[model samples]
Target: MNKTGKIYVVGIGPGSKEHMTFEAKTAIEKSDIIVGYKTYIDLIKDMLEDKEVASSGMKKEIERCTEALEYAKQGKTVSLVSSGDSGVYGMAGIMFEVAFKDESHVEVEVIPGVTAANAAAASLGAPIMHDYVTISLSDLLTDWSLIEKRLHCAGKGDFVVCLYNPKSKGRQQQIQIAREILLKYKNEDTVVGIVRNAKRAGESIVITTLGDMLKYEIDMFTTVIVGNSNTYSVKEKMITPRGYEL
Candidate 1:
């Protein structure tokens, strides 16, 4: 009987090698095979020279995870990569589900990396310093009604909101609708920070008001941080104060 090899779910972090956790880097180096979405694989092409790579396009997550598990079962160390922390809207959960369904005994390890919220917030000067909620606008798997409910709750709770997968070619209307929902609770002047391609190439940061945010360019790579009532902008930076007295 061949010994099963381990699988590592790695988060590459915001398309920048510097943002990747040391553990994540080490896992990729140790893996005999690297599997991930094509975009994520391209982000780390420098590290994949000697490794066997299997990359596919969007919406093929199940196929990627299954392939990684298969390689692991064949006694090959496998690294399954995601752009952000794998557990947060990444491949870690799906990988676990696949492994469990197959009743496979291969060991699995998850390495965390800086997620988009963290990277975008840092680039915009701590817009998430207070309590925050992260939501993905993509409704590919999740129903749009469920996502709308989450947006309403996040808005009513006065929580700093971080939006992922904000807008794409076919998904342009969701963000617009989200703004309207958030406006019911937040002030029109509430500080909003938009970070595109955070911590990566062609990064752009814009600090605007909730009412004015829509005027800026936003897309799938952009992270939109809508501040709570108390959050404010200063010196071109968006900040949500933690209520510490000066």
Candidate 2:
């Protein structure tokens, strides 16, 4: 315990031990306290035996980061965990912002992990091999109008689009609207990949087309990939070729 304890923002990937990176494991092992969402904390609970753990449900992100920083200020090594890459809609950025705003002097390190888009893509097929954009269909923090503009732009550019938080129990129409917007600019038969619970238990992947995407059930766990104009399916594998000739 010293005045200069360090904080590690670690990405744990999908809620599975297999997908958790070695760097994340090491950082957690070296930390004196663990802080993350309740679900993500449970993912590595076995490895955290006898360690101090602080977990909370959704909307507690700022509280969680603040607690971790306080623990670090007390000369404790802290691990702030996030699902997927910490920089991608995860805790790293938030932690840094809070640290800078508070003018804390603790060192910070970010460890990257496999993202939902990559994990889901591996399960379904390669739909983002070319120019692509990653967007979250949820309108919680972002305005719906802005999201719609981006969706329409992605469609116009024929960019392979990776969608996060496609749908949930309360908000089911965002993805449906996204599907409709893309349909206007892309072919009705454009390929779309749906993956639920990527890299975790009961994982499911479906390769369908733009016209039929709305028929499938989706939730926060699902990651949807809308293929570009050149994307196609070969033997159930959605491949977006990078212009390589055989």
Candidate 3:
């Protein structure tokens, strides 16, 4: 009987090897096949030499995960790559779901990496030193009304909010709506940090107020962090005090 192969869900972390965790890299190195979105695969293409690569475009996540599972069942070690932490809006969940439903007895391991929130926060100093919530404005799978409710709750709770997939060409108004919803609870002067292409090429960091964040350029590659009431900006760095009584 052939041994069932293993699958490793690896997070690449901000499209740069420097930001990727050692474990993530190791899984890719050990895998016989690497599968991921084309953009993410390109980010680490150099390391994938002599390896079988299966890449697809956006919205093909289900196809990608299914392919990885198929490869694993065929006794091939597979690495499913995702940008940022795999468990955070990445491929890990879908992979597990597919595996469970199919009852594929393949060994699976999830290797975490620097998620967008962490990478964006580090780029603009510590804006989430206290309680925070990470929300994605993309309504691809989630309902818009549900997202609004989450935004409203995050605002009312005064939790530092990290927004992913803030905007894109076809979906532009969601970010604006998010800003308006957050403004209902957060003051106009609340610090907002925007980090684009974080830890990768063409990286840009903006420290602005929630009232003026929309004025700056934002897109899918950007991560926006809205500071809590206690958060502030000093010397161009956004900081949220942890209330250590200093």
Candidate 4:
């Protein structure tokens, strides 16, 4: 039989087995080897206990992809895992980049999963119901100035904004900067919802206002959802009506 020299770049979704898709599970079940970030692999340690696993740390993305590709080239099925949707800030793009540059002929599959924005929105009770835009405050690969420009546009358009990587140890001021820019276009009372570790253990959900958003603690695990000009907070929910009139 011809070797199934293929690599599956799968999204496991929010680090919970329940949130993981059947397609993702099946792909990993079929794969002979699995490679991903150490945190991601640890999330499913029990499920992948018997599989040949190669785990990488925070910044070694290229090395992880290269290892997966090399394993596939040896006629082994490899599942390269990512936390959220493989296409969104995940390993799928990296795998494709490596594959194209090296002209590797291995078959590649990309599976989608829930991203932090969507997961946090759901936990916050539909803050993303209206027109919304997602922006990551992390400037590792993107420039802070460009991110600020996008924030400005979202503010002018009154788009509900979902922010990823709001604050980390090294970069702590971007969230405050984002709030300042949005305040120019949005009200100080605009509703804001903060979700940390969505759908995972020790998850935390906090509802705040644009005026006092900075008073709360934020980190890489947190996702901040800012409502549009029309968004409202009632009881325990942050909701943006989809312009449907009763």
Candidate 5:
């Protein structure tokens, strides 16, 4: 609550009212204006119908934040909501870049929410409890070569890899390519968990080995968790539980 104005870059979690955190709910309830992508706004439409709302299309990340800033300049409490935790492949970083680049903006605070990583982990049963790393499969901003390099490194390091944006129409094979890269260091029997629409109404969680991954079709709503050598599956659940017994 600073004089420059206040912007709450809020994360709404994975498209579910029950999964949304209390703090995130409180922030949304208190906000004077809610700005976000159209689908996300529609997801929480009932709670925000009375509030001033502004929504953008799928590919308008910067424009969305800029529009939120304009609302902030008017001394309105603006909430720029993201689908998952703002820090993890969400809108927080971009909003920060916009604020810093422009300068002289409102107080931007990122209120955290359950990300796909957390949701996927929960769905599949603690596959990232120990040392792990997260990577995004989208090559829109990053080069696929760099993604391959990182995938190789993560595989070599035996880190549990949480992957975001695993599959879309344009980049369907990116995850398959990453699986091939990881297979070099891992095994054909290495456990992998695919959680689609995690925590949402139509959520589905699948646990299979690396060899079976090609048979499964993923989407943008899916978050893929590929286990390390130490990880395994039990009763069809991919688990990387803390090594307490060992």
Candidate 6:
């Protein structure tokens, strides 16, 4: 093992080549090794020509981070890649966690990128324009009780709610639970928008209502925007006023 090793936890933005920031590109181009999940690896495949790449798929996040640590320990400048912002439910946190546990590994530098929340908000006009609370409906890392509590709190506070990981193959009821929680403070006609595969090919924006969300097919790739009591749709675009109007 050499001694000049450093780890860069790079955010590749969402999924588009154009979304890849200049700083991210520079880091990848300069890295001695690139490590990430398979999807993230595929997303930046072209940028990794002639670069040593180690990609993991369907493995526990700790396992992936451990591999990245091993690569970095070998004195290789490594880039740990994550789709969307690396810190937004992404790999940056886990990588740092591993580093902290092992003093032999140096601290990691996290490079921020545009998260899905930002991209989804852009695609859906301004659904998250004002005060909004972003939450993930996935119960993997968080408990359902906490998610429900946040959903109700966000609804009562009239904050636009941005939901991530709304649905997946085995987890299907969390979104419905979230919908029920929001319905207490939101009207059935309250506008809700769904942005799937944001900034990627096959991107789509669906604007509907609190009641209509159940009728739509949602997946892990989707980002759901549930409007507050004051949210509305104009010209078929969802817009939540930030209260900046005079």
Compare the candidates by lDDT and give the number of the best one: 3
Assess every candidate by TM-score.
Answer: 0.99, 0.97, 0.99, 0.97, 0.95, 0.95
Candidate 4: the clashing residue pairs are none
Q: Residue 15 deviation, candidate 5, in Å? A: 2.1
Worst 10 residues of 5 by lDDT: 1-10
- Model 4 residue 5 distance off true place after TM-score fit, in angstroms: 1.2
Q: What lDDT score is found at residue 161 in candidate 4?
A: 96
Model 2, position 103: C-alpha lDDT score: 99
The clash tally of candidate 5 reads 0
Question: Following a full C-alpha superposition, what root-mean-square deviation does model 6 have from the true structure?
Answer: 1.4
Candidate 2: regions farther than 4 A off: none
Candidate 3 structure quality by residue, lDDT tens digits, 92-188: 9999998999888998899998999999999999999999999999999999999999999999999999999999999999999999999999999
List lDDT for all candidates, in order: 0.94, 0.91, 0.95, 0.92, 0.88, 0.87
Mark the regions of model 3 whose C-alpha exceeds 4 Å error after superposition. none
lDDT of 4 by residue, 1-246 (tens): 446489999999998888889999999999999999999999889898789999989999999999998898889999999998889889999999999999988999998998888889888898998899999999999988899999999999999999988999898889999999999999999999999999899899999999998888789989999999889988889999998889
On lDDT, the stronger of 1 and 4 is 1
Model 6 clash tally, residue pairs: 1
TM-score of candidate 5 to 2 decimals: 0.95
- Tens digits of per-residue lDDT for model 1, 162-244: 99999999999999999999999998999999999999999999999999999999999999999999998899888899999
Model 2 lDDT tens row, 1-246: 467778999999986779888899999999999999999998889989989999999989999999999999999999999999999989999999999999999899999998999899888777778889999998888999999999999999899999999998889789989999999999989999999988988999889999998888789989999999899998889999889899
lDDT of 6: 0.87
Residue runs of model 5 more than 4 Å from their true location after superposition: 1-4
Error of 4 at 105 (Å): 1.2
TM-score of 3: 0.99
